[model samples]
Target: EAGVAQSPRYKIIEKRQSVAFWCNPISGHATLYWYQQILGQGPKLLIQFQNNGVVDDSQLPKDRFSAERLKGVDSTLKIQPAKLEDSAVYLCASSPRDSANYGYTFGSGTRLTVV
Candidate 1:
């Protein structure tokens, strides 16, 4: 099975700088998700999208972070004025609309470092 694709496997930036990450989900997937995984901690759901519409974004820091799924195929996440606590691996995952049986497909993730 094909996997999700993420760009810039790693990144480094000074605090308060801006950065962006991209993701391409598996073909035919209707649900896409973005997560933040801090070192030694479990992944936290940042946002979720069903096709081109947002399904959830309660966890996203709207003041500093934003994301969009264009045409329901590709997605991008951006963070402006990043903070030290923002240093984490930004993971992209995808699944079918009713994917309760099949688990999610995850990308290698973009590791961000805010010093």
Candidate 2:
């Protein structure tokens, strides 16, 4: 089975700098998600996309963060003027559907550090 793909395995930026992460979901998958994982905490869903539309983004900090799925296949997440508290692993995942029974395939994730 094909798995999710992510790029720029790691990044380092100073406070107030900007950064971006990319993701490519498994072929034929219909659901994609972006998560923020802080050390010692469970991953938090930052955004969810079903096809090319946004499904959920209530947790995303719109003021400085944004994401988009182009043609429902590839996606990108960006953070401008990043803060120290934003240092964490940004994970990308995909699933066939948003059901309790379906499992997601996750990428290795991009580790972002805001110094």
| Candidate 1 worst ten-residue window by lDDT | 96-105
Q: How does each model score on TM-score?
A: 0.96, 0.97
How would you encode candidate 1's per-residue C-alpha lDDT over 1-115 as one tens digit per residue?
6799999999999999999999999999999999999999999999999999998999999999999999999999999989999999999999987565787899999999999
- Clashing residue pair totals per candidate (backbone < 3 A): 0, 0
* Residue 51 C-alpha lDDT in model 1: 96
The C-alpha stretches of model 2 lying farther than 4 A from their native spots are none
| Model 2 CA lDDT for position 41 | 96
Q: RMSD in angstroms, all models?
A: 1.0, 0.7
lDDT of 2 by residue, 1-115 (tens): 7789999999999999999999999998989999999999999999999998999999999999999998999999999989999999999999998774898889999999999
lDDT of each: 0.95, 0.95
RMSD of 1: 1.0
